[model samples]
Target: MKTINTNIAYKEEGTGEVLLLIHGFCGSSGYWGKVIPMLSEKYRVIAIDLPGHGESKALDSVKDIEQYALVLKDFLEELGIEKVTMFGHSLGGYITLGFAEKYNQYLRGFSLIHSTGFPDSEEAKKGRIASADKIEKAGIDIFIDGLVPKLFAPENVESHKQSMEEVKKIGYEVQPQGAKNALLAMKNRKDRTEILEKTELPVLLIAGESDQLIPADKTFTASGENIKQVVIEGAGHMSMYEAPEELGNAILTYLNHG
Candidate 1:
């Protein structure tokens, strides 16, 4: 397929096979701060701050998950990169699924960290809308304040205070319209379980044992000889921040042996 038009912003480091990182909602490339240094030591790492969420300009014309996947395809082609092992976190996972289904030509493999292949349930859709409304009425900061803490294991919040604050700082920078658009996209995302069920390529699923957003069981929708799943102890949704060392090791293991 020909490259679609896009102007995505990204951070690249080290040198080896490409490992693309797609951050979750309200996050930027900075989300992989600790993990990048660890993984980049052995392999090339490229972390992108998706449009409207990082330095990239918002795409007002594109409001669906399919468009987000196209944007990523163009991002890779623009850099002259041919293929990559993509790892998507939370909201990023939804986009990764879209990419895997439509743009698997560029994927060597892919992983979903603390994410699921299931679609948002009816109740979950309402919650997504509620969050968008909250951002519109109360403001982004209020929504971020309440959202960030819930992303961590409640018992470990005090210990991971610094990382929690860093996440909040990043969340605050998200463009309001961009954030709303993402919520709408997520609320309407399709079920992608079948995509994983049939893939023969290496597939890795990493879930936080204590993930407050997506349970470990939920992330394991598909299983096969080619699928590898790991559950990190004590981590919540943001494993990149809560347990970077363990998260990095899990990713390294999948890349090296899977």
Candidate 2:
């Protein structure tokens, strides 16, 4: 693994056609831990720690979703990866759509997992601002502990408490500034629904049937003719953790067929 400090910390893995995995806010490349081994069998999975999260340094200025997309563009160019299949989860998914809009030709396809293409609702944006304020006041650990439970369905939290705790630990490790910037980016993101219609490459939208964050109905509504939406039953926002095998299978099937 390598770390490149260009406002963000990026890590690369495996070797083949590059498939970039972007994690959600308060998440790191570790989110891909379960799915990487399966994907690495066929493609080079480049999982990145978006700025302010994971090992990446926090940005001095707040970044918008488009800026994050540009950062990924620069990261890819630096690695000499001309073409890629991008996978974004949650916040990562939002950035992936931005990338598709600006750099679609550079992508073989794009996948959005447990994410949304719609701009944040006023209430959601207000909530994000409130979250940022909480992180600034109570510290990252307290915020993470409070946030993790809401990230998954109630059944998942009940059955996978340990796993959920581990995820919370990872969230706690995240820098406060990074988490704050993520919230700012998310709140300021624009709706990129048109990209779904414009991009010729196949698009895959994966949502957990039980995910309350980016519900299946919203995902289906945003999907175009070129898009395929898959909802994993018994899974929540963190589907890869709740149903890794199923998520892995869906990804592999799409990659193989593409």
Candidate 3:
């Protein structure tokens, strides 16, 4: 594990083509604990704790998705990594699109895991703001506890109680300021469908069959010869935890076949 100057904490293991794992909202690099070792066996795996979450330092000012993308650019530059295949979950997915839009030259490929290229709807924007406000006023513990369960398919809440608790624990570790910044970034993100439609780079869109947040259709909306869609059965948004073996196999297949 190493920390970049901007306090981006990352864990790197194994060797081969670089595979960067970016966790979603309220998550840290630890979110990928179950799958990283499996993937690392085949490719160098670098999992990062985005600013304000896990061991990373919070940014002093509010930041956008592009800003986060730039942070990743700087982090990779610090590591002397010129290119990588990136897998982004949720918020990480938005940042991946931003990175692809501006730093496409550095990308070998990218995947959206339980994420969307669509910008927040007006109603969704309002909801994000409301939740941010609630987190600010009432604190993150209650907010995270209530929210983590919703991220799972309703049916999974009880079946995956231990995993849900791990998620909540990670959520509780998020810097409040960092959480606020992320919400704003997500709310303000521009739709990046154009990148999906035009890029020559390989793309993988993975959806959890029971995901309540970003459904399979939404994840699979963009079609292209370079794009591949995979639906993980009996899983939800937290498929990396709920179905790591299937998810790992899907990723391995994409990396090898793409």
RMSD of each: 2.7, 1.4, 0.9
User: 108-127, model 3: which lDDT tens digit per residue?
Assistant: 99999999889999999999
Q: Model 2: residues >4 Å from true position, as ranges?
A: 5-7, 223-225
Residue 176, model 1, lDDT? 89
Worst 10 residues of 2 by lDDT: 1-10
Per-residue lDDT tens digits for candidate 2, residues 1-258, read 467646556666678899999999899988888999998887888888888788888876647888888889988887778999999999999999999888887899999999878999999999999999999899999999888998888788889898798799779879998888888889989988777767779888898989978888777655556778788999989987999899999988888875
Deviation of model 2 at 224, angstroms = 4.9
Question: TM per model?
Answer: 0.97, 0.96, 0.98
Better of 1 and 3 by lDDT: 3
Over the full model, what C-alpha lDDT does candidate 1 score relative to the true structure? 0.90
Model 3 has an lDDT value of: 0.92
Error of 3 at 37 (Å): 1.3
Candidate closest to the true structure, highest TM-score: 3
TM-score of structure candidate 3: 0.98
- Give the higher-TM-score candidate: 1 or 3: 3
lDDT of each: 0.90, 0.86, 0.92
